[model samples]
Target chain A: MTAVAGVAMANEPISPIAPVKEINLAQVELGKKLYFDPRLSKSGFISCNSCHNLSMGGTDNLKTSIGHNWQQGPINAPTVLNSSMNLAQFWDGRAADLKEQAGGPIANPGEMASTHTLAIDVIKSIPQYVVEFKQVFGDSEINIDRVTEAIAEFEKTLITPNSRFDQWLLGDKDAITATELEGYQLFKTSGCVACHNGPAVGGSSFQKMGVVEPYKATSPAEGLAAVTGKDADRFMFKVPTLRNVEMTYPYFHDGEAETLTEAVDIMGRLQLGKKFTDEENAKIVAFLKTLTGDQPSFLMPILPPSTDSTPRPQPFD
Target chain B: MTAVAGVAMANEPISPIAPVKEINLAQVELGKKLYFDPRLSKSGFISCNSCHNLSMGGTDNLKTSIGHNWQQGPINAPTVLNSSMNLAQFWDGRAADLKEQAGGPIANPGEMASTHTLAIDVIKSIPQYVVEFKQVFGDSEINIDRVTEAIAEFEKTLITPNSRFDQWLLGDKDAITATELEGYQLFKTSGCVACHNGPAVGGSSFQKMGVVEPYKATSPAEGLAAVTGKDADRFMFKVPTLRNVEMTYPYFHDGEAETLTEAVDIMGRLQLGKKFTDEENAKIVAFLKTLTGDQPSFLMPILPPSTDSTPRPQPFD
Candidate 1:
């Protein structure tokens, strides 16, 4: 353990407090541009924003993420907002850092499906990109590492830390309403705290979906089974942060429920083995809305030049 | 001619500048939302910005504006960047004011191609849009006239003032480069100033293309012929403003030339009956670039709902 000095802290960092890194503004700016560019995708239609859109709670409101081939992924799209806070990346903790996460979608057969050489070539083609890359990377050559670092820097800046929950936690009593406060009390008492109780609310841990009642798994996704290749991990998935959960719907590993009310009821039944009345559900829904904070005008990273100008095709087109 | 009682400008106003009505921000904001909205188009795909995009110099880089049914217009899409100052509307000057101009596109068979009634109905269908219309119009009821008024108000805000030319006029010596200053002098002396001089640089007047050189009958467009059906008006068209001309490329009414250099050569040969050498062309191009000023972000009046899911398209089906 002593041999791997930083590796021990890598999994469970000394506090949820972030370790500050001197960021390159140039890289962040370039990442902002690349994040908005659709050229990164094979079809040139599926931008990073297509799935992890900032305007829409950082996740496109789809049950499963639609990609270049219009092929839907098994799991719901994770919100990119505050994703920098994650100890490990992806629903099943596949990537150890943001840099690794950045390369995942580009080569994913269902997603961007772009080779590294092709992605770099496409980016180098744009005059604006050329100027920006030269400014950001300096004498260092432009490649996948630089691309990942730029994107990672940009992801770090997407920390939405001033929500009402944060304000309430910061001792602003009036930040949350009385009903929302009561719902918070109910949340703790109902034993939802088994997995979801942290600064990110739930991303600090993972839990099996059918802890009490069978989750009645309807999604085509085998949930965490694809990642673990274990039958026991079949229904297991990451416990998503509820930071902006109100805006990100339908809820769950597969976006089966359209509204928070239905999702809360399902959670109560499956996760806690508690049946809630309609009035209780309404109160929880009201509490969830308070979690949805105001977002600033998203200056859409200038739309990257696309190879094709058509709707994304599906099923490995 | 002295028919109207309160029209004092006709007799003699102290200032030659007409008293234009101030723009209503509330209406302009509404109009801006409507302007960028693809829902206004039949395919629910195209918006005003689809053609007059801001990032790409207020005009889509396409040779001609594409519309519904993939039909291409004969004339190049003019920049809305600073179009508010134009004396008349469109290449042929058919529309008298911004309101009339705004109305023309929606109803035009080759443009948005929606009737005012259908447009309003389409907007009203979206609950968020319905709320925005109510807030802006004050229950005045959604109508074509209101749409025109809102769009006109928005267009007034699209004014691109304070170019290097404006700064130079204001006694800023370093506002424009030395080559641009020399080019300006040449522009004035070359008899090009006969019609291409005004507040908007060229929007204040109309002129016959190739006035000195018997107007050609070879271009794709018959200029003002389509509007008036008069043989004399065949080659007559409004001289476009050079405000953000550097960005809005493929110049001229027909977008015949691909670059500013080529456009300059063609204009010198056909209109001025003189040839501009490479050095002279470079100077003129430099001067045109200096005309570009910073374009502020067009603040959309209505925002999409906080939810991640875009309200599904229900226009056609």
Candidate 2:
């Protein structure tokens, strides 16, 4: 590893995002096929990649995702990139980990709308998938837990590493522009780094969306309160990772902030109770753009054809 | 290349499908990004891969494609695999080549529903795409022609080579099962090889869907009649490639035949005016399975993010 002077120091609040070094090749391969296979959905059209698109920075790039039957999701779809670093998955931190979170959307009426039993049946019916499951898990029995576990394992490998900011952190002084450097300094000094610190840059803990003042938005989500049913947890969401925040836009839980500049402005006013000049906002946006890293690269998995015995996808019915 | 007793001889009707030998790397790379980039669609949720999915035998695996606003398309989507081998594009042969065909769905109201002008506008606004276009095309100018041309270049490389049948034809006697070999002999003697010949096994010419009997289908498509404006061309459609026919199920122009057996049975009755026994149909299906070649392999392209200046996708509108 390159030695840096000021950044990634022992006392530094944030750490450099690390690249995946090792994983079970068989499990990862199986998970990738399942991730792209849309037959898991009721309509046979929605895969895990449909919402968390790897082609577009692990997001669908919509304000809120278009789900089953074109139902608009209540909250913005979070980026699956580097999500393992988060305190928990989802804005509410409802699921404790990626494994638990993987099962939610498949059964959600507005999302994939597939029962766990149906999803398992679909996978089990495919001979190739069945062979793979037996090879990976040492048994032919397919279940929701094993399915989600494999998916989560694949999700762990979705981290983006070697960003320009990461380069600068690892002792390369010329990695970032002067404007971006200024923005980084301002970002830390302005107290934005308090919650938004870690390898993922924000997923370390939960924080209120509006700290100093109340946030006004049309979204009806109660954030952590929805999970805990506690009045105090209202508006408390897991702080989203700022890594690759430029691409994963229409920011925040509600997706009300369409641009980085607007999101920065809103964050300053509602969270920190401070207003930033246009110049500063532009610099921050520029700095945020530098967070885009090398995305995951792998051959697109070829899914096995469904057999006559396989339950057909009832798209219309 | 291997020598076989009778198959792949100079006088043989069938030829082996060859792998892509040459291509422009830059153009293919850029085209791949565009193919998977859903931002080209009105909803930012549909791309070339949506209907002609790489994961699912280069098809959506639907009877008819689900298009923009959930509108069901008029005809079944043809497989993009080895489509360049076709005499022309689309079932009706309306578009002259892959390049022409690439632009159709983008603007089709029921499909992607994005006009050429709007699609160009979207691409032009993304700084990264602009830079890549200039690098690949050697110009700053972005247009529909160049866009489609690049996409067509990529499609040319999507050929599936080295199928078991091809191996058997290349003189690997054990490559195929005995039943499959028997079916191949039956296929040739039964005159099924007349239209389904050449490397792609079918795309060399256009043929009447029902040569001896009227085909019963609900699709209103008049096949080549729409292009030629002639009564004789009413049921004449471009012969689809039998390559990977096992995966490209729900066969026939209208996707009315849901299985290989059903399709084989229909073709026997309609085109040849002969009925195949159950044993013969099973053997043919087994032979068809041998046509599933090695699928194309490439890293999934990471698409450039849409900029703030880019027009936002009007999914609901």
Candidate 3:
């Protein structure tokens, strides 16, 4: 982690996750249905939940996601658990917001593999969705913008608050163990806190993958360089939020590190130019585990059935 | 809906769907998780919900299902909602119960494409599941039998009661309109109720696909003949429950019919040596729409993360 911004090494660099109170319930409810609806994809088998699954820390729990037609994704899909906190979306930081990011996967050939027109057509064909759009947006129009907006609104509600760390931050003395507290101390002193500090614990900035040394990326993705077309931006990616990181495994952009211990060791050697003892790495890992928050518990949305007019899913095609 | 038994059709042929009272809560909960778990598959992509999608009337709303590696399913997927009322499971009635049916898809090459051993191994590797199995089964052992039993218990709770038709059956005069009431009368008088009786409106009997005439099946599945190896049993498939038939589209074993009217028409011509008028078909379709019940609204369970020892899903492989 490198490009530290928003929160300097102030008195409280890492803030406790605040509980959300304000949200348009109708919009959120509509968005939840759309989020789980796979008909948005050409295949009708892959929904937004396909990659960013709510069950397993908002990730598909795959190293790299299996996409449309079983096409292998190049990079490890990021968790959507607290993704709203990210400065930008994607490993390349190409999309500026969740709404913009929502549309990318639906059309991406290696992802949901459906174009905007096709998705809109499919959604509009379902009468219930048309009604829902009218109710949410005060119009009967079903367009890509509104669709993405609804999805983004739903994503906004995906904030995971009240981890043991947050409880500790709020002055609960026994919230974390002594070893975990020591780990937190080591994490701050080792300079890991510089970039990985925020309400989300690491999503406010784009940072080079290997700050101290060159990282041997297993993926072909060039991170921010792919977007910026600058050599300096190469290997730079949006620092992923560490909230519920315990459930999101096979760590890093390439998913090269399968375990937290391996990931911690790699970060130490590459990001901070420091080698940690096995005990030290274990301590840091324990601290990271404390970041596991209370996951969002929502009823599995019941999607409206497709009508005769609705275009059929050409999954094999 | 043929070979009606259990219900004599003496006083009331079609009974109101009774509200469920007794169910194994712990087993049901555990089963619900497993039902939604895609890790049972080789790809780790397809869950039981993929085909029997609870969102869309417990059916995928596809003609046939799209399965492992996007292999097209041979028959239309039956709704899991109220599936417990069915006398037997699967289109051909090959599986005697939900437990037996649950095991079929896991190993089915065209479906989930994972062995029972592989699925059990995956479940056993996850510590949370191991603990849950112990709680539910009174032991820490993870096996296919207990796994399927829990799934069966969960399926048993999938009984969807309180449809408008059920309300109408329970003496609510305004629960249905004149047109729907007329259609229900026609359904009984025209002999449609002979097969599709009982609380499920179907199930409890095996019937030939085409009783009066031959049907051109879209897929090559042999129906009951494949299991029994008897020429007399050829095309004799289990009658699908018409519960939530509105959502379970592209009706029949072949999934060729796209609309309820079309399915009704075909059934008249092929099964009853009759042709339904357009108005009659519409009426029946309207009455069928009244069968849509309150879908199971359960909070999406947060599944335990896979550990290093867990076998990786090989979608491409």
Candidate 4:
């Protein structure tokens, strides 16, 4: 182990976030419009931005989301920022990718609450949307597949790069403070890094919410069991990314913890069976706060006006 | 009469739309963030943009707006574009200016449903917002007065200029077609210009909906009388701006006319006691469409994160 320990690897660590990469301009723009357009929902008031708001760390900041008909979301909304790095989509990791996840919320009874047929029909009825779909897909047809594809393309660009920790990892010595460095050392030495180690600092795999202690969550979600139907998978949930964790508040699947310090304490006790000193918790929180990087910036998209043929929104019965 | 009528007027006519003028950058930026931030509402899901959406001709395109707890609005929302030119605010002209109008919806029971105290407390809790308020107001205090002022400053920049009609009015004779020119002539000769004349093509004065004929409306709104508490002011409303009229659908205070042709037909029949031919209605409608102008474009403002001190939103009672 000592003989190979000092050798430098050829490949750089992926945890240090990278800058914006190549993207399809047309698809991203089309997807951006769809992301902001609320007509895709039955109520026509809740857009993708309504839940995954880019303005505030790509989250609604509520303990749980307020969905269609003001129904409470089953779980705390995971941040959409840097979500492309997740192994799978949703807390249960039920969906394979963002494309699959994009289609779920629009038709979910507690979410946007609109069927694919109705959403497609609304898009088809708008003449400008028809033209835009033709421009992007080279076809007049506007369907769920094309819609999700465009939205997923847009989601890929929502990466937040150049955090202080990332800068430190990229060889800038002054990017992080000495306290923060000590906190980083503790983070790696502790069992916390076992599951939370990738570019997203988590989300590389599904892990049980509690290992050393049982968690009595108020939310009735069964986690991975709902997807796999296996008793062993119960309470197994996708670990959320720690990138921009400062801004994405009310942490954890149930969102019972309200602050980063509270979340840290709860996680350490439940997941690691360790009691962190107040100073240790403060240092770790300070380190986590440095993960907030540059946010995605773009003009609020101008949506097309509905024509006479466009189906009117049924906001209330 | 001939000697006095031939003299050229020195003061410019305020009917033809002009380009966007000066704006306060810092205040507008602060206000833009507030305009898009939903925390101003009790539900933390509605913003100024929810109803006055700049993306679609500064109107929500609903027959009436869906407000707090899904309560339906009493009157159709007026387009915010070129609203600074309006003599007063709201369909009933209750608020004296944009600044006065900005505070109404935030506290209105059926609208944002957030009290002034709660909204101020929420903003004050965010350190970044405190800094922003300090930057704009030369003081650290954040209040309803300051909030409304900043919002009004931003709303002033919502003007839509450089329309085809504006280009024509500004000496580009070829900008409009022959039919459009005929429509403009009819607009002046038929006395429509008496109420619908200005840089905004309307919004200059309060006018009765039915001038020559008694008109029946489905909406129970009493218009100006609701504010003035006078029987004579019944059905009197501020003439809505015709700028981007094509995009502001379900026209008039009642939002009963679903099409521009229908709107024109109703206006002529009720206001002037004239029955316009189909060709005349088409020409008038075509001219109105030329009023569609450049929309306001800017990066969506990233909102500051809420702190522990920030009051949580109470969407449901």
Which candidate comes out best when scored by DockQ? 2
**Fnat of the models, one by one?**
0.03, 0.74, 0.75, 0.57
Q: Which whole-number lDDT from 0 to 100 does residue A83 have in model 4?
A: 94
Docking class of 2: medium
Local accuracy of candidate 1 as per-residue lDDT tens digits, B1-317 = 23332243232211122233666778877887777665566544456766776545667655566665445666778888668778889988988888898887776778776667777777665567667778888883778888888887887777666677656664566888899978876776766666666666678777788766765444567767778899888778898987767667667887766677787778878889889889988888777667766564543232354333334322222
TM-scores vs. true structure, each candidate: 0.70, 0.97, 0.95, 0.94
DockQ of each: 0.11, 0.79, 0.70, 0.62
What are the per-residue Cα lDDT tens digits for candidate 4 across A1-317?
22222121113223676555777779999999999888888887888988899998999877888888778888889999999999999999999999999999999979999989999999998888899999998988788999999999999999988898877766676888999878776776667788887788888999998889999888998899999999999999999999999889889988778899998888888898988999988888888888898899998899988877878777775
lDDT string for model 1 (A158-222, tens) is 76656775555545668789988777667767777667656556777667887889888677666
lDDT string for model 4 (B39-91, tens) is 99998888999899887788888788889887888888899999999999999
lDDT of 3 by residue, A206-306 (tens): 88988888999768989899998999999988888888888888789988888888999999999999999999999999999999999999999988888
Error of 4 at A68 (Å): 2.1
The best candidate in terms of lDDT:
2
Error of 2 at A262 (Å): 0.9
**After superposing candidate 3, which stretches have Cα over 4 Å from the reference?**
A1-10, B1-10
User: Model 3: per-residue lDDT, tens digit, B69-173?
Assistant: 878788888888888888889988888899999999999999999999999999989998999999998888889999999998988887778888877776666
* Candidates by lDDT, descending order: 2, 3, 4, 1
Given the true complex, what DockQ would model 1 score?
A: 0.11
Error of 4 at A42 (Å): 1.7
User: Which candidate would rank higher by DockQ, 2 or 3?
Assistant: 2
